[model samples]
Target: MCSRLRWTISSDSLRGLLLACLLATCGDVVAADPAAVGAIAVVVRNDSSIRLMTRDEVYAMFVLDRRGDFHPLDLPESDPTRAAFYMRLAQKNLTMMRALRSKLVFTGAGRPPQQLDMPALIGRLAADHTAVAYLPASDLPAGTRSVAVLQPSP
Candidate 1:
């Protein structure tokens, strides 16, 4: 009886462990699928003379590498939309981006883009024709026009 009871308990524990592992792996798979999330839009002020930009141009502008007449605006680091924007458009995660920006600042090569909340970002874009930013397609404000849609490569 004692041996039988031990076997039953061991089997139950193994089943529970397997279940936990499956659940964890499934969550990771879902999160890794970019199609599961909304698309990101690179935008400029509606009245801006610049109508188009390539992915490289957008990336350079964001990283403060290619200085142009236009200004780049960023959402706060904690915002998920900002994270998605960097990941999709610039092929960078927030931690990597921060490290790069820090190195640039330390070398006096460049500074990070100005961070703003959603409302302030919208307002600034509306008023400044030279300003550029990225936001979720659904969340783009009225006075901004999407210059490019950034998506994961299939």
Candidate 2:
């Protein structure tokens, strides 16, 4: 004779399991193909006085390090370019970046850059020469020029 056992989960346990699965799947959403994602460019208005930026400077600016007179603009949280920018250049994932920004805001230290859509971000850069941002190299607008081209790590 053969015997079998059955198991059942409570609603709370089912919800928790589903949540864990969702989080696990959503984590590390960065694109695996570098070519598909394209290199990211740290950019400023074409006529800005600030010509170039080092990798460290770019990373600091994005992380709200209180750098020079530049205002760092951020793409929307759901944008793939935003994910690539943080993952490739800053060596950080969205979760870590969000947590850091939250802590900074809580402690009254600093706030994350203003998130904007592509058109609004481009407009801001055009209007505010102090504005700096990152986007896929191919998508860079004529009003902006790349200060630094950050390639993905091998």
Candidate 3:
């Protein structure tokens, strides 16, 4: 609880400072939106050739220690995002995602997620039907059907 309060204070102070700075210079703080920092879903292309999956399957695809649940994708051993991804998504601290990636890559466990911008990820999802990527609904790519939106796990 103490940590939570400290974090709240830190984030609030940072956000408020940013807002104050923005208001003093620009007309608004929207040039940098904090809401943009959240977990986006990693979606796959909806190819009939590939099997459809549930959230369980998707989560299982990444949760490394799960029995009989090895990652189906060929991930690098030094992926920098491996641990942080788990923390941000699994642990639900959005700020930690990049840090996790840095740690993974530095340790040579894996590489970061292939940087597919929203449009690219969506287009691939529509055509491949077997690809998975993280994207927010508000920033969804074209031609892809959202089976489920990624929510903060309670």
Candidate 4:
């Protein structure tokens, strides 16, 4: 009975933190600029025919499920911003991310998202239309279009 109570408590606390992270970066920021999110770019491989995306579309972009709609790529957990961005949509929040991604990597559930610095992120996106990843507007790569605005991953 005590274990169950503890589980419930943990779950509730986790949900609360996730909600807070949904509003910020790394579960730390109190607020995020909507325009900043909008300026985020989604790039795909040249082979892919897709053009623009909605928030849901962006979320779907990184799923490795064969039956899934969008192409999901698993990236390393080193970058806090990318991790937070991923948690904003993929996971409920940021807490379980490393464990979750590690588990996923082992299970072959999917490949990790490509971890790229600003230049790499732009270069990768520019090279592939089927490859979808995000980059800030300040460093957006040439040939990449602002497909959609940044949104708290729902």
Which candidate number maximizes TM-score? Answer: 2
The CA lDDT of each predicted structure is 0.74, 0.77, 0.44, 0.52
- C-alpha lDDT of residue 80 in model 1: 72
TM-score for candidate 1, please give it.
Answer: 0.72
TM-score of each: 0.72, 0.74, 0.43, 0.53
Arranged by lDDT, best first: 2, 1, 4, 3
Which lDDT tens digits does candidate 2 get at residues 31-136? 4543357788988898998888888888778876575777888886667788778878667777988787778667877667867789999999899999988888
- The regions of model 4 sitting more than 4 angstroms off are 1-39, 45-48, 63-80, 91-94, 152-154
Summarize candidate 1's per-residue lDDT along 12-101 as a digit string, tens digits.
Answer: 224558676867545422134344448788898889987988888888888755647887888765567777777786677767887888
Candidate 4: RMSD over Cα atoms?
12.3
RMSD, candidate 1, Å: 17.2
- Give the Cα error of residue 109 in candidate 2, in Å: 1.4
CA lDDT, candidate 1, residue 26: 54
Off by over 4 Å in 1: 1-36, 152-154
lDDT of 3 at 16: 60
Off by over 4 Å in 2: 1-35
Clashes of each: 0, 0, 28, 22
Model 4: per-residue lDDT, tens digit, 85-104?
66555654445655664676
Query: Which residue runs does candidate 3 get wrong by more than 4 Å?
Result: 1-42, 48-88, 92-95, 138-143, 152-154
